[model samples]
Target: MAGRIKDHLSIDCNDEGAYYVEARVNHPLREFLNHTDSSYVSQLLPAGATWTATTAGGYIAMIQVTTFACGGISLGAFLSHIIFDGPAATTFISSWAALTRKCGEEAGSPNFDASFVFPQSVAYPREATLSALFSPFLKKGICRSMRIVFDALAIDLLKVKTASSSVRDPTRVEVVSALLCKCIMATFKAKSGIQKSTLITHAVNLRQRAVPQFSKHSMGNFLCMAAALVRANKTGLDNLVCHLRKAIRKIDIDLITALQGDGGWLKYCECIKEIGKASHGTNDKIDLIVFSSWCNMGVYEIDFGWGKPTWVACAPKTKSKIEMVNMIFLMDSKMGNGIEAWVYLEEQHMAMLEQNQELLAFGILEQSPLNLIVS
Candidate 1:
């Protein structure tokens, strides 16, 4: 069923289905998959079905299935960020596949209405300025996205490198994000010939953090931002991990309660303000790097009647979603223990980053999905 948007952001559930497309390509999937150029990946994704506040009654989800000459298929889905965050999108895909397989037990019924806890009025105030809310990192620019794979061995080494008395055991996401941030900071310094203060924001899932916690199956944008700052000189991995851990720890029960309160928007505004303040106060240029982890979201487990996907991927660099500079999206690799980071930056910095020995030591840059063996 399609969700029709009413005035004040209310959704009217109707029988109309989501936007879907199916196409056949004469070329085999291996031709594009094995190709060195990553642009071929975008051909499998559906386009021209985006949602905006003004686009009333627009479909909340868009799906495309492209079949190759070799009989291999590519299933691509694009969920509206308005109502679906990473976890919500994963749940939607999994449930859709379960229904296709006639597995009623695996299907999930998502809760579309979350207004009781997060009212529309406070969610987005008419007077709020988006520029101040996101500021430096929320602009369109020429970005180059590179796929970097960190095997389990690299992650274990990173954990050892980041370990300290304060943070005995750091997760894969933390160590990877820290190492990437360190490399990015170095890249910025090399480009500008001066060290710059960097602000790192990681997307935090609030579904399990909120008081009277919402179910994992609950829908809508249950996401919050956690900010960690790395000064120009203090670009150590341990320092970055410490700051990241502290900022993420701040998104506790109290913060979630405030986000769910009547003055929820105010609380959110304050959080953004705090982030802005934290990002400033330095004379040097501030570089904002955004990180979103889709690891352990069960995306690889999404199996239709055809069986599970051989490899899952984010959209190519041509997509506008990651056009903003310094965006890093981390996902669980096909092996389930490793991580694949989609790092987006400006072309020049990306060139330097791709050659960074420190980064390349821990990650394999632009690895082909076709050659990936999921054992």
Candidate 2:
């Protein structure tokens, strides 16, 4: 599938077959699972799975199956974000698992008419405008990726620490995301010796936010980008959570309806402009971190008749260091309530972030997934 961005965004299905690869590792599975380095785990995925246009030799989906010396198997799937969102990918995997297990899975058909619902107009922000607006995120640099797990206990304590009359009962994602933002802000200041205002943008799933709520099986990019600003002095957990909550709430039914209306493109451009404004024009004095939460998306529940997975993970952005920097992918931990954050940051900032005492106080860095299992 190719995403052609001209007058509007449209996906062209070229009937290109999905890419698949099988590999074997000489090392034991336990050896691989014991480490949290993304580069190491990335070996399980098919190399060069990055999505490109069909003419550019890109595949809409890429699959890799790797076997370890100890007979353990790992499955890696890379789906194009242009064509599928988290919920859509989850539905696809679940149905595939059910079919593999011969369970007669009846995963409902997917809805691919998002463009029809939120049709793009001449008012839509052109690719150039978007590129300029989000250029900071598109910069290349020496980036490091790692996973940090926030267990239930830590999350509960965070809720308490961040609880206020104005902000109470913060969701797991909210609290965790806030903490990460706060820590990253501090890390950046310490590294650069200059406190910078931070921009926190979250990818909100539109399936449940829309007025009619798109089905879970709907395909295409059905998401809303919500962002908030945290001044250098207001990076407190409670304050950050408030900002996050408010930004996310702005994507509610009213906003969704507006985005689908005739002036939808203009509304989207306005939102993007507002988000950019939150960072005060994106100079060195401003930091940007993008978050995509896949929590509660049933990622860990995928099974191919071999029982539930011991762990599920998102591959880091190592393959293309130029693509994403200061990004976080949040997914459910094995215990279900906890969140495992897959963070990507510049090398210098990551070196400091990994050693942040305040962050380490509430989160476990690089813990093995096998240890989460209860025998």
Candidate 3:
């Protein structure tokens, strides 16, 4: 493998291994892998990704470019999650695109000094302890991913429905999250015949939440979780939004400083442990749903000299213990006006969630025209 071979390679090998496959498509790219059913795209990803082959680690990341007979092309990336979160990962992709066209500002160095936020006195909990607490979610659930699209009209209508004198008005992310929260709660209630206390957690970006906001170039995971607890009967969208808003507003610099340095882990562990033990007696189990919005993360804007991506998504093989905790990743739609929610749920509840009337009313996948061209 010579560096000069980067332009293109012609390899002659018997098709007995997994790294490459030369295949033919019998239909249009969109029809074969429809936008409405994005889950199908995840199934074909493992072979298409360039996996890290060894610890010698020559590649921190791998890129796969696939061409279809209908002239459609798809770009996929396999990034090390240990090193990059959603925003950081998108930054890398965008920088590559900018370099391809030579049209963007010079890239700046990333900030890795975490001491700028947390003091040496602050201590984080042991990773093993945190993992043990959430192990219950990882042990027995079968995870499934489903893509839900909310066009611009549906988003506006949700805002209208959620606006009221009693209920606090919400942002697109808030209202949408609240709507999904209720849908899941309703599904659980209908299945169990009893209401249960549940938690909703959203991953909030800490860069903008800081006192003197951190630069966008600052790297590493700078995310804090904002959580709200909703009791059995108060699972209404309005109630959820209100609780969620309060939780988010409470994530000030004081909370960030405390959570990072001042015995935060000890208190958090005790709280979660006590909640779990207390719930064992009431015949009501706790359900946690986590949402992370990547709405303006610039992932959809990666052009790479071919064209902007028609669809961008995280491959399912990248799924980890986090999915078992029930998570949703909300991304900006290709059109830039709506949201696309990639929801990962336990297999048993997926059917019920898809059929959720209120969710269906808002999230209906709309197909976009694809342009097929060359590099």
Candidate 4:
């Protein structure tokens, strides 16, 4: 399955932070088989495919790049995690693109060098315990689900907010993620009426764990979870922002400790299981799971010389009942700070959230425009 999916190339780009660039290619199944060649792009292309790129302000741009000889169209999309959390499955797109371009240059050269990746051997203490405690959830098919809903009106409001702000902080990615976390937490508490049961989970990368002198290029899943406890009935956007800032600050410590060859991963899994069990029994699960990352930072840096990607976004392959959201920074040719966020939730829950006009005012919500590409 991995081999089949790694056959295509994808690229992301941006122009002065104004917009994002996205490009993808698809080949007929017969053509693919006949080529008998490996390229980063080819490796990333599944048998049948589709693709899309979402931008900030609730705009979705996409392409069904090619129809495979096998009688199916290749599909793809660029999803922003604000709609779910973290980059989700969109990381595969960039990785695939990198691999494809590399293969194009050196037919047999390995596209990715996993030697620098934090070995599972070093991550064992935590993984072992987590596997023992929460393997059941994985066995029962633990999956993640995400939806990218675009809202024109809300996006307009976001523009207004960005324009009104005078701070020169370039951390727009962190700002948006923080805001989403605040809104989601407020909504969860309001609906559940459990003021005291509020917590937020954030993922942190740990490439600098064992070797502080190591270069920053090391990739793969070198990450850990950070949790924050929120006070009940925390209203107002400013208050929420304050809380988010503090939560983000706490991530550094939590992440380092968790990645120190400790059993932190197990503890994290146990915490999640406890939350799940609590949600099943009393309806009070973690208030919100906020996922955010600066994936767009890698957008322009990745290109196959097809100009640059018009947009970049994220899409998750699985769905879960958990309350989660993700945010991503997208680039477009237009001016101003444009960020795109994807949201997924049950209709009832979403409708109830709509009642909070202030939060809803930030961005518009539209049905996800991306199609799921299942292998």
RMSD of 3: 7.9
* Candidates in descending TM-score order: 1, 2, 3, 4
Q: What number of backbone clashes does candidate 3 have, counting pairs of residues 3 or more apart or in separate chains?
A: 1
Which structure is stronger by lDDT: 1 or 3? 1
User: Which residue pairs show backbone clashes in model 1?
Assistant: none
Deviation from native of the Cα of residue 247 in model 3, angstroms: 1.3
The global C-alpha lDDT for each of the candidates, from Candidate 1 onward, is 0.80, 0.79, 0.63, 0.40
Q: Residue 68: error of model 3 in Å?
A: 2.2
Candidates 2 and 4 compared: the better one by lDDT is: 2
Candidate 3 residue runs with Cα over 4 Å from true position: 1-28, 32-35, 43-60, 104-110, 115-140, 165-168, 259-284, 316-325, 365-375
Which scores better on lDDT, 1 or 2? Answer: 1
- lDDT (Cα, 0-100) at 358 in candidate 3: 84
Off by over 4 Å in 2: 1-11, 51-55, 104-106, 120-136, 280-283, 318-320
- Estimate, for each residue in 11-39, the C-alpha lDDT of model 2 and write its tens digit: 44655567788999898988887775646
Question: Cα deviation of 127 in candidate 3 (Å)?
Answer: 2.4
Candidate 1 vs candidate 4, lDDT winner? 1
Ranking of all predicted structures according to lDDT, beginning with the best and ending with the worst: 1, 2, 3, 4
Query: For model 2, what is the error of residue 111's alpha carbon versus the real structure, in angstroms, after optimal superposition?
Result: 2.2
In candidate 4, what residue range of length 10 has the lowest lDDT sum?
Answer: 1-10
Candidate 1: regions farther than 4 A off: 4-16, 49-58, 122-124, 127-132, 277-284, 319-323
lDDT digits (tens) for residues 97-175 of candidate 1: 8988999588676776677887767347543433346654454678777889899999999999999887899999999
TM-score of 1: 0.91
Give the TM-score comparing model 3 with the true structure, all chains together.
Answer: 0.76
